[model samples]
Target: MMKKITIVASMSIVLLTTACKTKDLKMKEDRKEFISNKKEVVYQVFTRLFGNTNTTNKPWGTIEENGVGKFNDFTDLALKEIKDLGVTYIWYTGVPHHALIRDYSAIGISNDDPEVVKGRAGSPYAVKDYYNVNPDLAVDPANRLAEFEALIARTHQAGLKLIIDIVPNHIARKYEGMNNPNGVRDFGADDDVTVESKRDNNFYYIPNTQFEIPDTDAPLNGEKNPLVDGSFKEFPAKWTGNGSRRAKPDRNDWYETVKVNYGIRPDGSKDFPELPAHFDKKSAQEHFDFWKDKDVPDSWKKFRDIALYWTDKGVDGFRYDMAEMVPYEFWSYMNAAIKVKNPSAFLLAEVYNPDEYRNYIRLGKMDYLYDKVETYDKLKDVIRGHSLPDGLSDIQHRMVDIEHHMLHFLDNHDEQRLASPEFAGTPEKGKPLMVVSTTISTSPTMIYFGQEVGESAAENAGFGTHSRTSIFDYVGVPAHQRWMNNGKFDGGQLSESEKSLREFYKRLLNFSLNSTALMGAFQELQSVNRDSSWGYDPGIYAFCRWSTTEKLIVVTNFSWLTTSTFELKIPSSIIRKWNLVDGTYELTDQLYQESKLTLNVTHGEGRIHVVIAPSESFIYKL
Candidate 1:
């Protein structure tokens, strides 16, 4: 009986231990699955500049023309290329229809001008109708909805997300019915004005009462001459004829985009011209009310419906163009409404000014905004052969400042390319610098189209009224080989410099994707001593990213010359491993018998990489 009792006890103990081990293993597997699922890489594609099915002809027809031959299907062609790059998200730029009116007489046309007939008609930023998809981009006419659904389905199948562009600011300058030469019909303070003021025009004018700008030697309205008057002018008070003066034939007047008046007008008429037509506290609510329902002008209800239509079709997110120009409340409302349909949908805003962070993200609830400040300052400095100060302490501080809601990039469609000598100096020097900054920055990195290949910024690529041309030239090819044909300017035909940059980008991207430590939030390691070059060089930046389960240390050499004899002290509690990404390194035992890792960087070619090892960080364990 004693032997039997002991056997039973042992059996019970074994069973309990087995069950506990199984549970722990399952939990570990679950965590790994979660991390793997959350990994995402977004590839930006300028639709007009990307490859076209018809190589003989340009992708864009004319500004007024639609349904040009062999449209590039979003699902069939573009998404395939993105997936080939191992990217999980596709951010398609400027899919909406732009202005239709030809302003050649006013803006003056050049063959190389982006707005000219180089590719398609219309600027994607100048949205003509918010409620409709440009037919040119549509894959099927009768089953347009089906096509969009299929595209989303394909993206999901291929493990990718689709993000489209949304323009909430001023609509196309020549939006239909808005081009009426006569006074705006339904916009004034009247009950029976049935024309719907919101739909008739692309912009909602803000009345002058909300904010005030000092009147300096500001340019006069309608007059080419500069104002010499020293006296200040109440905004919207000095202007005449609804204050709507055509600044240029192609672009709308500045007053048209100014915020609406939120205060009560002195005349008691909401249509009082004396009030600066800015979207202020008072008029915004009314405009919101007017557009919330289908009854208001420009059909805000229809716009909402269009958004819903796309969301229902399964678009993952939207890249709102010129987001700063719109009201914060509008975005808040839109974001909430969109989230109701798709909770995980990403909302990215193209905000030029970083000062509007409070309005754009804090109050607005946006997911991400372009981090132009870091890209322009610290990143640019590194590429220009400037060493970071004190173990990149300054860079780390700046990174932390915008860490919560920042988007890092080496180049975007709006700026000059990093490959350009003017901006990046030279590809050989700039490529590695760009790679290091992108990898170590405290935000998810974004690679613009052709950036991997170090494509230089064309003359018309920057902010302009012209239609963007294909950054690469793709002409000739047989009829059957038309679709994504191996044309003259394929990805494989990159220049030597471009090829080097591309490989470097691929390495950085692969490193980020493979390592769990580099994808999420990280802590900057504080240096114990200030005398070391790693501690003082403004160019050498390093940071550690650690989750509860994983830890990673990323170090970057931003200078053109080799950095030698830099000492990095590791805590005795952590296990250290030395691996080289761009150069050679040796570990030495130093003070306190702790291992010291020394890295020898190559001249003009620096290293940027993440070191993943257990118990590596001083403060936290991953």
Candidate 2:
């Protein structure tokens, strides 16, 4: 009876903490004036797969069969070539130590059970050690962290920022903090199993329960684990990463990982300090100041320390995985501490919920969110011929408030390749889309490695379906291997078509990288030109963008079968805004400057004739 009363008293103390004053939340209008500039090209490379030359792709293959890439593979010359693609930052995915099927038991790491790991290489999201680098990426396993540190130095030397993944939502089911620095405590090391929920407990436990291994009765990869004597035990089973409370989670569920607790009760009410209602209206530093003196939960502090430790290692930034799954307050707390360590840190996180976008940004302190579901999805629909060009206009209108804060990309680790059979089936089909995606807004643009030469990702990797490259298995990318040219880092072995495709990506990406208009002002001409021509196919779209010194008209034909010629009209409003008089101006295709076209202005309206081939786009500068 006394223990029950003590627990109740502690719960009351947690619920009775003072709330922040709402008056402090009303912020100055220039709240976003201090956001770090992120107008650079980010190239996301699944590091383990990027430079792997091995082509022996067998299902459920071992490291010796399907070889892994090392950190040294990112040679100085290789990085320079990527820079030639106009890349400013390189996000190295799967850098941290994660669970894998291989036996590193010789060294302190043990082979993870197949039932608890995703693929041969394992899912990168299931980090095993927060303080160590993946030994697979090192030339010498004993010096993996040193090799990664050298890579960081090399990336900075090549004038590119380095980005690594930080998965805050969960960790490997076999979560053990190996190689933790002094004073750093492993998660769940001090948990009290008697309680169902505690503010300081790192995980939520279904007390008095034991975890049941996922239902994998059928042999995985045609075999079952030799060590499986029908059970692997864990008393007081914790909730799975996907919020599955069942001890026996489904195979499709995130059974390989366990969720991290951040002071949210099982009923979803926050048990920690809440940011003031209008706190997002204030500057980022002010948000930081608000939490500077507050008592935060233990999980929040641990993640924050992890971030700071990396920032101290000269890491320029982090790309948070499934950021929205972790509470926004944790980001608000963690990112603030990161900024204090490195003010210009590039913090890009993946978020899908449109409704939570602003809160994740202004309150959660995320620098950029994935522009996937809105822009990327709509654009993909348009490319596959199921949707019209007007959807882009709708997206632009919807994202107007936070346009610059959304990062645009067609391919990432999680998405299908541009050339996969399930997608466009060829890299040529992505040219027009790439041009528009990179230039349509002022946000940062990201392109995956091998996306330029059209990596089909057709390898039947172990745990994942084909279409997207296997971040989980060690597999060589065919198209990219040609460009790697073994150790030459040149495209000497590339075929004519592959070389041409790379050239196209280079031209489009470089223009976006250097164009003043792209960063200055944007005005969509889609509405005006939608009905300008009689045969005006909805497959074509146009827009105008300008800076003081740069004024241009951009047009693209999304069709793969139709070569369309049309008179693209500039609305009277745009012509007047540009201060064009009743005269003719010479316009040249910046991409293919051998061609010149004429734009005639009459009665304050501009008329330009354009002939574009299938899957073609033009940047006409006046």
lDDT of 1 by residue, 206-247 (tens): 344222323222222122222223322332221111233222
Query: What is the Å distance of residue 329 in model 2 from its true position?
Result: 1.4
lDDT of each: 0.44, 0.82
Runs in model 1 with CA error above 4 Å?
A: 1-39, 53-81, 100-120, 135-150, 177-303, 385-402, 432-437, 458-491, 495-500, 519-521, 525-530, 534-538, 561-565, 569-622
Number of clashing pairs per prediction, in order: 44, 0
TM-scores of all candidate predictions against the true structure: 0.61, 0.93
Residue pairs with backbone overlap in model 2: none
Could you give candidate 2's per-residue lDDT for residues 322-383 as a string of tens digits?
89998898898899888877888999999999999999988988889999989898778777
- Indicate the worst ten consecutive residues by lDDT in candidate 1: 17-26
Query: Which window of 10 residues has the lowest lDDT sum in candidate 2?
Result: 2-11
